[model samples]
Target: MSSVKKVLEIQRETIPYLYEFKDSKLTPFSSSIEEYKGQKQAYVVYSFNKPETEQGSGSRLLYTRIYPNESAVRTTGDFNTELGEKKENFTLNEIKWSVYEINGTPNIHLKGEKDGIVYEIVTQEVSLREVKELLATFISN
Candidate 1:
């Protein structure tokens, strides 16, 4: 049996958020956890893997929303290089974004599988503040 490297990273600031279960096998090219408008958000990636194309996740299709405060959610039957491509309207106040989008950066990745399979529990939003507040709760518990 093989053990996967899972590390939970906490971004410190006025509002903090945590990134849990990050893969260790992959090497990051540019990675950092910082604060955005009083919200702690992370911009992380590996030279070997990224949020979109790290493992076996295949395909990113584009779509648009027809509502205010609404965005497109990327759906994956399983997680790998990507959770999927999820675009949000930001106006919805219901559109989720990060755990995917780190900082002001966008992720582009190749798709596949690793050690059977891996999945990410994603919660996204337009505001880093909202993302921070949300994940802060995800970890404190």
Candidate 2:
């Protein structure tokens, strides 16, 4: 009897507090702010996955954003929107401490400190169905 080989491969990259999944060449959205001379400090975190068919286009699979000291995750360009082209902001604070997904949509999870208080932020987006299927497979095995 002969046995077949099953292989699972995942590619990940990190660059200065940013993370990219799937294709390495895809651009990640990120930004930050610094305080000087007792001035107020601010920070921003964002990322998204480009569509497989379109490269360098603004069509994103999962979009996430976080402002300094925010307790909720803000998202734009959700999949559920008509035509998936609307750039509206949505917030997710139901779950804390983790970025989660349901049926392909993504919820970005983050943590930050402000005014001596630590809080968690979770942003949600409607991702492509294929992405959800891939996640399901990855998790099942």
Candidate 3:
């Protein structure tokens, strides 16, 4: 189970250095991605400067409720591939778009159904060193 010790809101100017992010593994991200947000918990997302990119466009921000001892859930719509585009293996289906997990418990669905759909992905425990590499991958000028 995951816990949100505190809900710390970080302004854009105060965004943590990409090098400072620790924990959580860096999943294979698209090269078109413009920016990414690495939160303490909650959810992760990226936004695009222009419209979007199929390779690695949009912003990636990680978000989670900073509740103490309470499990938090993140939901994505997968609409228009705002968060990401369809992979070579995966197709866009109601079931494929949803992200549900147990950390939220009873009825917490990551990538909630409706706004788009929900695809529950098990977040692998990440090491600080590994995070550094992820930060490097998401870099764009």
List the candidates' TM-scores in order: 0.26, 0.26, 0.19
Could you tell me how far off, in angstroms, the CA of residue 80 lies in candidate 1 after the best superposition? 20
Q: Please write out the lDDT profile of model 3 over residues 1-141, one tens digit for every residue.
A: 111112113221232321112324332232111222433222333221223443442233332211112223333343212233322232232222234333422222233222221223322332223322443443211
RMSD of candidate 3 to the truth, in angstroms, is 15.3
Poorly placed runs, candidate 1 (over 4 Å)? 1-16, 49-141
lDDT of every predicted structure (CA atoms): 0.28, 0.31, 0.27
Which candidate model has the greater TM-score, 1 or 3? 1
Ordered from best to worst TM-score, the candidate numbers read 2, 1, 3
**CA shift of 133, model 3, Å:** 2.3
Q: Which candidate tops TM-score?
A: 2
Worst 10 residues of 3 by lDDT: 1-10
Better of 1 and 2 by lDDT: 2
Residue range 26-86, candidate 1, lDDT tens digits: 3333334333343333333322223563453222211111111122223433223343444
Per-residue lDDT over 42-65 for candidate 2, one digit per residue giving the tens place of the 0 to 100 score: 232223455667554344433322
For model 2, what is the alpha-carbon lDDT of residue 101?
Answer: 34
